[model samples]
Target: MLEEEYQPRRVAPAHLRRTEPPEAPFEFAIRTARQSDLPAIREIYNHYVANSTVTFDEDAMTLREWKQKFAYLDKLGMPFLVAESPSGQLLGYALVTPWKPKRAYRYTVENSIYLGPAASGKGLGKALLAELITASKEAGLKEMIAVVADQGAEASLALHEKFGFTEIGRMGKVGYKFDRWLGTVLLQRSLKH
Candidate 1:
């Protein structure tokens, strides 16, 4: 197991802002997630759970469950972001969660990024993850982890690699979903402080 110190710090909302806008007039903006965005976030996530191997979960999350998750992250002050159009349509989201609940693992967090089908390949995933890492560093996180599903999630893996993450471990047949067993790849990226 990996361990690091917990030195929580305040992350300014501005640090989570997107510095560069999309070249095309995509009518989208990246910003911190709000409570109201939970429904759309759930929809996007559930769509993946039901139709793709992006997530290993077999069931969709309820609104209350999503709200609870958002509240917990808010209290912990972890980074959670949303990609939205100017007219308030949610396009995608990215966030981080504790790698493990033990105190020794506090500085290590796992990252997650999800994009709506129509929003993929438009730089939203990259932009959102870049901001997530920046915010995690600002919050004094030492390591970011990605627990990837092994069923052809290349784009997600590539995104992490582009951000300097390296494959640290892989467990075969650790997850069973979509009527088949799947592997889990652990990727790690250290934020040297």
Candidate 2:
């Protein structure tokens, strides 16, 4: 997969003028992730793994690990999605992860959504989350949880809130990334209950 170079589009004080119409204005589609999409999905995820506190994993995920995860989620009949751009670029992804390992927690799942920096500030995140919520209900999940690793995750936090998720807990100083401590924000919404 080719990583598209970022280009500034809108007119800016004459200094940022190269965003021409050579490439089509961006558009994306929401769809279920497939085995073939693991590489693209890993690209978006590991960027944050290497650069941000959005995820607590300090190391990038290998394709083998990703394949295992795919197998696991598939066995649970959960939804894993990807947002593909008009040019066939994967702009973002959202999925339902098991909230915990306990047998009784099968009805509850955690939601994780991430976007490529180029896709930031767009409504793609919202659309993806909405799709996951619907998919979760259809899969018979009773509750959906979100465990955010950053207190500054306003975009993610707000997106979940806008979809009826409510804060249920918090864990302070649970992560340290890029030389600073970060907190975890817990939020939830009932899907079938």
**For each candidate, what TM-score against the reference?**
0.86, 0.85
Residues 44-159 of candidate 2 have per-residue lDDT tens digits of 89999998788989999999999999999999999998999978888999999899999999999998899989998878998899899999999999999998876567788888
Top candidate (lDDT): 1
> Stretches of candidate 1 above 4 Å error?
1-24
Worst 10 residues of 1 by lDDT: 1-10
What is the per-residue lDDT of model 1 for residues 62-165, given as tens digits with 9 covering 90 to 100? 99999999999999889999999887889999999999999999899999999999899888888998899898999889999999988779999899999999
